[model samples]
Target: MRVIAAKEFSDRIRNRWVLAVAAVFAVFALAISYFGGAQQGAVGVQGMEVTIASLVSLVIYLIPLIALMLGFDAVVGERERGSLDLLLSMPLTRFELLLGKFLGLSAALAASTLAGFGLAGAMLVMQWPEGSLWHYAGFMLSALLMGMAFLSMAVAVSVVVADRARASGLAIALWFFFVLVYDLTLLGILVVSEGRLDLDFFPLLLLANPADVFRILNIFSLEEVKTLYGLATVIPEAYTSPWLLAGIMVLWMILPLSLAAWKFK
Candidate 1:
């Protein structure tokens, strides 16, 4: 597992995938943080809450797509290349191999996210000394967890699908559902129900998607800015705790990967 993990990480580093992703994230983070309020005829570091809110929107759209694209081919590509059998013939279980692949890819994604966002955060902090340091750190961590959860789902798709083409399609479909369609669908339901449905139960539907969990985690942490943010505005009091939402995020990380491992075996 260690050997496989190291090779996977080193391969990403060698191919400059890490650098490319980090550059993309850093560019977007800086751009959003600095120019997000341009429509209001202002430019520069806004308040920490504002900057983080902007970046959260950016991450919700970008990170899951990147993570899914990155790992969608992990297992299927190996199978297509006829290397999966050879690897399985080695002294390792399928689960171990999958674990290594996930860990290595996850590390690459995490490093890129931190480096990119951390750079933007540092710049903002320098400009706005009053910003909450831990708040930005939490935002970055939640972003990383969201990336990992999607990556896990991508790997699961890689294992279940017959080829790379199907994996790619399924991964994108998952992204569209979770990032774009899920909330809209829920809102549609609410509209159709016309307040007849119990509103308090709405937050439960959010747990099914890691992205929604992330929104809740970050938005609620910045309590003062919750109503002013996008995506998730009114989480139930029970679901507002960051730790509980984070635990759900962890479950999101595990369940898909666990399914993949089961299918792989």
Candidate 2:
């Protein structure tokens, strides 16, 4: 598993895909960090709290898309190339192969996320006040977890689907559901009901979507960010604990990977 993971990681690095992703992340992070408050009529660098709130929106949209794209073809590509059978014919078990692939892809994702956001983080550290860095760190951590969750789902899709084309299509559909349609559907429900939906049950609905979980986790972590994102009025204080949301993100990663492992075996 270690050998496979190392080879896969090295291959992505050698192919320059990892570097390209990191560069993209760095550029976006910097732009959002510096210019996020322009809509609020603020000039110059925004506060760490406000910048983090802005980046959370960007992260929610971008990270999961990148993750799904990266992992959707992991297994199908191997199968298409006739390498999966050869790899399974070796000493490794199917579980080991899947595990190694996940680890490798995860490592690549993590490296890109850290390097790209780390550049922005470094700039924030230099310019922003010292106390709010932890909030930004929490945002980065949650972003990484969100990426891993989607990556796991993509891998599961690859394992269950017959070909890369189907997996690719499923990947896009998953992105649309989670990133776009899910929230819209929820909003539609709320609107159709004329705001009569119970606030208590609404959080459970938010918890169902990993993207919303990511948003709630970061938004509620800091009071300032919560206000900036206007989540203070909607999300209850009781449900905003960092540890609980983090656990849900973990479950999101585990459940999909478990399904993939079962199907692969």
Candidate 3:
């Protein structure tokens, strides 16, 4: 299993598209820092925080793109290239094979995200920010878990679909829905309903969508800002707790991964 996992990881790392993704992320982070510094009138911790927030904000879009690119063809790509039968003929069980592929793709994403945050953190630390490195680190960890969830969803889509194009299309559409449209639609619903429904259930309802959980996580983590800056105005009362936000994210991470693995068998 370990060997298979290593091979899968290596295969993904070697892909040119993966390298391109790394470059894009690097560029995006640099741009964030440059613009943030310009706007803030100095290069310091606040600038760094802006950079981190920008990068994290980009995750809603980037994470799904990376996952779709990695897994849209996981099975179909192999099958189209006439490698699936050969792979199945190997001694590895379906579970091991799936795990190997998922771990590899996920590791690639994790490494890139962590590297981006690490570089940003070093810059922030050098600037002597009042914030702890631990806070940014926690945010990075959450981003990674969210990335894993996205990857699992992509893999499941790939496995169930027969055509690579269709699979990719489906993955991207789902990404748009969950990461972008779903939240907007939910807000519209709340507005149309005019708060007539219980506002109390919003947080629990939000758990059904991964992006909402992520946003809540970000908002709750910035407690001082929540209190002083009134940033909590956007957050529903039920999602005010970091623990609850974290739990919701965990559910989002686990449910899709489990369903994907089971469906693969």
Best by TM-score: 1
List the candidates ranked by lDDT, beginning with the highest: 1, 2, 3
Q: Per-residue lDDT tens digits of candidate 2, residues 1-265?
A: 9988898789889998789998998888788776777887876777777778788888899999999999999899999888888889999988888878888999999988888888878877788877677877787889999999999999899899999999999999999999999999988998999977776788788888899999998878767656766767777787778888889899998999899999998
Candidate 3 per-residue lDDT, tens place, 1-265, comes to 6776677677766765556666676666666666656655775335444555666678667776676677667767787789888888999887777777778778777777777666656665566466657667777777777777777788778788888888889998988888888878878988999988776656566677766666567646665444553536645666557677677667765676677678777
Positional deviation of residue 185's Cα in model 3 after best superposition, in angstroms: 0.8
* Tens digit of per-residue lDDT, candidate 1, span 1-265: 9888888889899999999999988898788887988999998768788888888888999999999998999999999999999999999999999989999999999889999888877887776656478899999999999999999999999999999999999999999999999999998998999989987778889877899888888888786678776434446678777788888888988999999999998
In order of appearance, the predictions have TM-scores of: 0.96, 0.95, 0.86
Model 1, backbone clash pairs (residues 3+ apart or across chains), number: 0
**Model 3's TM-score against the true structure:** 0.86
Candidate 3: worst-modelled 10 consecutive residues by lDDT: 43-52
The alpha-carbon lDDT assigned to residue 252 of candidate 3 equals 63
Which TM-score value belongs to model 1?
A: 0.96
Give the poorly placed runs of model 1, Cα more than 4 Å off: 230-233
Local distance difference test, candidate 3: 0.70
Task: Give the poorly placed runs of model 2, Cα more than 4 Å off.
Answer: 40-42
As a TM-score, model 2 comes out at: 0.95
